[model samples]
Target: MNPELLIAFLASTAGAATPLIMASMGELVTERSGVLNLGIEGMMLVGAVVGFAVTLGTGQITLGLLAAMLAGLGMALIFAFLVLTLQTNQVATGLALTLFGIGLSAFLGRGLVGQTVDPLPHLHFPLLSDIPFVGPLLFRFDSMVYASLLLVAAIAWMLARSRLGLMIRAVGESPDSAHAIGFHVIGLRYGTVMFGGAMAGLGGAYLSLALTPMWVEGMTAGRGWIALAQVVFATWKPRGVMLGAYLFGGVTVLQFHGQGFGLAVPSEFLSMLPYLATIVVLVIICRNPQTILLNKPMSLGQNFRAD
Candidate 1:
């Protein structure tokens, strides 16, 4: 590959991976706190529609991003209430949330279809973007891309070193013991789950406002599922999530560019490549149960009631 083309491909790969990094990191934290909220796809869809609609109506990208996060947070609150307060099944509520988000976003975005807004602007440093190759690869990207990287770093630090991190880990490992030992298990779980939802919404906002800048029903296109798989593939490690997201992001970009490179494969097959890679990764990971058991939260997906 030409050096210039290779640089562009890498840049595109980073852009493609940004949303997954943010969303999966959020889920990683949520699961660490022992809550399995599987409604990421729904959250992303609702966020995309809400973000696009708000941006279109007000012409303010900031407002659009805020609205997207709020929308996702609201959906997560619903999930938290059902699973935590009402003691409903976590898996069922999460699946229902995804269905609800799909329908609601579709309805909300009906009129906004085909409309386009300004995509998120790339941050160009003065001398940095002027540099030969390093500038384009590292210095020129939307703020969110850098933000996602920082988010990953922050989460990793918090989970590994902070007192709060230890508390969260304790809660996830043994909620009953955590509850007995002066921890507000329900409260912490609610906080983590809500955070996850906001991140998912933010990821969706990145899709509509940055990646494509338009509202399409289900634009998320199962990236949410891929994000979930990322959490598992990373074995619940924050740094691992970052790497897994980039790996998938690279695959996604490759699929789009494969035909142009004369791979001679059907476009449909190319489109399916990202998903196929996801299944393959999941299958390989599942084959090694020990890897999962080592880091997975013990109380994940369980309903907790305050005694």
Candidate 2:
């Protein structure tokens, strides 16, 4: 590949990875809090629809983004109420949430289909955008790309260095112990879940409003599932989630780029690379049950009871 093309490819890969990174990182927090929110895809779909609809109507991308985040938060609250308060099974509730998000987005976006919104503008640093190789790769990107990186850094710090992070870790490990110590387990779980939902929503908005600039049914195409797998692949680490997402993104882009370069691989087989990679990584990471148990949240997917 030409140097410029390679740089461009890397840049596009980063751009593609942004949404996955955001969603996976958010999920990292949710799972860290001992709540396995499988409804990430649903939250993302709702955000995409709401973001596009609002942006089309109001012509304000920021509002659209906020609206998407709020919608995601609402969904998270519902999930929290069902799983945390009512003690519903996390897996079932999460699956229902995904179904609900898909149906709602399809219905709500019906009238808005085929409409377009102004894509989020790209940001160019003064001197940085001019550098030969790094310039095109690092300096030229939309605002969402930068924001995604910041989120990764912030999340890593919060998880590693903050008191709240400790509380979250405590709750995930043993809500009973946390509750015994007055950590307000339920409240902490709710907060973290909402934050995760908001991040997932933002990821969806990045896809619909910024990256693609259009509405399409089920456009996320299992990226949410990939994000869930990434949390496990990373052993619940935020930095690992970022790296995993980019790796998957690179695989995804490689398929298309390969096609562009006249690779003889069948398109169907190429399309399966991301999901296949996910499964292979999972098998490797989870090969040892003891190791997985050591890293996994003790209470993950379990219903917590106050009694």
Root-mean-square deviation of each candidate, in angstroms?
1.0, 1.1
lDDT score for candidate 1 against the true structure: 0.92
lDDT (C-alpha) at residue 268 in model 1? 83
lDDT of 2 by residue, 87-172 (tens): 89999999999999999989998998788899999898999999989888888899899999999999989988999989999999
The parts of candidate 2 lying over 4 Å away from their true place are: none
| Cα lDDT tens digits for candidate 1, 93-186 | 9999999999999999989999999999999999988899999999999999999999999999999999999999999999999999899999
| Top candidate by TM-score | 1
Q: For candidate 1, what is the total of clashing residue pairs? A: 0
Worst 10 residues of 2 by lDDT: 1-10
lDDT, residue 221, candidate 2 = 92
